[model samples]
Target: MPVKIRAATQHMAMFSVDADAAQAMIDYSGLRVCRYRPNRAVAVLMLMRYIDGDLGEYLEYGTNIMVNPPGSNESGMRALQSAGAFIHHLPVDQAFTLEAGRSIWGYPKVMADFTVTDGHHFGFDVTIDGQFAVGIDFRPGLPVPSRFTSKPQVHPTYSHLDGVTRETAGEMTLSGVRYRLGGATVRLGQHAYAAELASLGFPKRAMISSSADNVEMTFGDAKEIA
Candidate 1:
């Protein structure tokens, strides 16, 4: 584990996408989409604001599809054991993180013009090359309290770059969490990636949404998986 995000905030939403549609997005990434059901798959849209970390301060927006763990092609229903994630598009507002992400773990991090605003609800907007990309608003839900220590929970992450596919163990823990049933809103823009998301059905009410006021994560060693 070389990269560490010591402190940050994470807000994310989950949506169910057509398994086939999800697969199409990551076909070239050498990762397999996890078909949780007969025809259903899952996609996660995550927003992260890093206050302190090895990569320094930065903001990141990611569109990711749930994936089947490497070396297994089981009948997609085994999502519990194969909770890997393959990032389809990742956007950041800083250059150093953009370069480090791509070079370190092969994360598909792209430069973007982005901002976050706080009020009754949270707002995030992004533009790429001066073209509008996406806008998202989140209303913090009820707080979930836990007295247990924040322990590291490892999850699989996949990335493909320069004709190489890598797998990493991303361990993270969250504190001061809150969740809402239907408080997330979004708008897609003219960016090509936005269009791609539209193809898979974006700008809709997510199945669920959650926000973590604090987060700590360590990106473990990356291994060639494909």
Candidate 2:
């Protein structure tokens, strides 16, 4: 259906999780957590502000689990290298985008409110279902080489909702990108979903955090994962 994001300011962070607890959080059929070790898994969090896009202006927050690609035996570094993600929770502020995300890609998108502070250092405060969820802040670390910046990379993502699982190869290109080791700070609040995220060892520093000022993305058809 042709989804494109023309300009955005986004922040992302990665965290390590106990694989068993992570797996219990997902509990989706046909999906396996990619263990970084015997019991460690990777969890990812992102906050994005889409200034221009086919879906219109909206804010989004996501928590995803690193997973083995469907039907693959890859594990550890191999699976990490595979770069496959399974969406656990996605919240957006726009109704149209919310419906579009779910109807088109089976994304489990829920309506939420966001308070954003934009700049070199970015902040996002998200409230879900009328309760405060999380407050996330990011600080830049070092410059990513120009060669690596503004390049398109297609990311494989899986989503299971309403008894349907779908895979999408979402591509993004970015500029003004900066990242740092342990660059993220998070605060948990009254929402139950916030507690759900806390299960993965939150209220702690992120292993890595990054921010980009201008970004572009594209999403095409979603393939059913058998």
Alpha-carbon runs more than 4 Å astray in model 2:
none
- Local error of candidate 2 at 171, Å? 1.6
Native-to-model Cα distance after best TM-score fit, residue 84 in candidate 1, in Å = 0.9
Best by lDDT: 2
Per-model lDDT: 0.84, 0.86
TM-score of 1: 0.94
Consecutive 10-residue window with the lowest summed lDDT within model 2:
70-79
Q: Write out the backbone clash pairs for model 2.
A: none
- How much is 167 displaced in model 2, in angstroms? 0.4
Task: List residue ranges in candidate 1 displaced over 4 A.
Answer: 75-78, 147-149
Question: Which ten residues in a row are the worst by lDDT in model 1?
Answer: 73-82
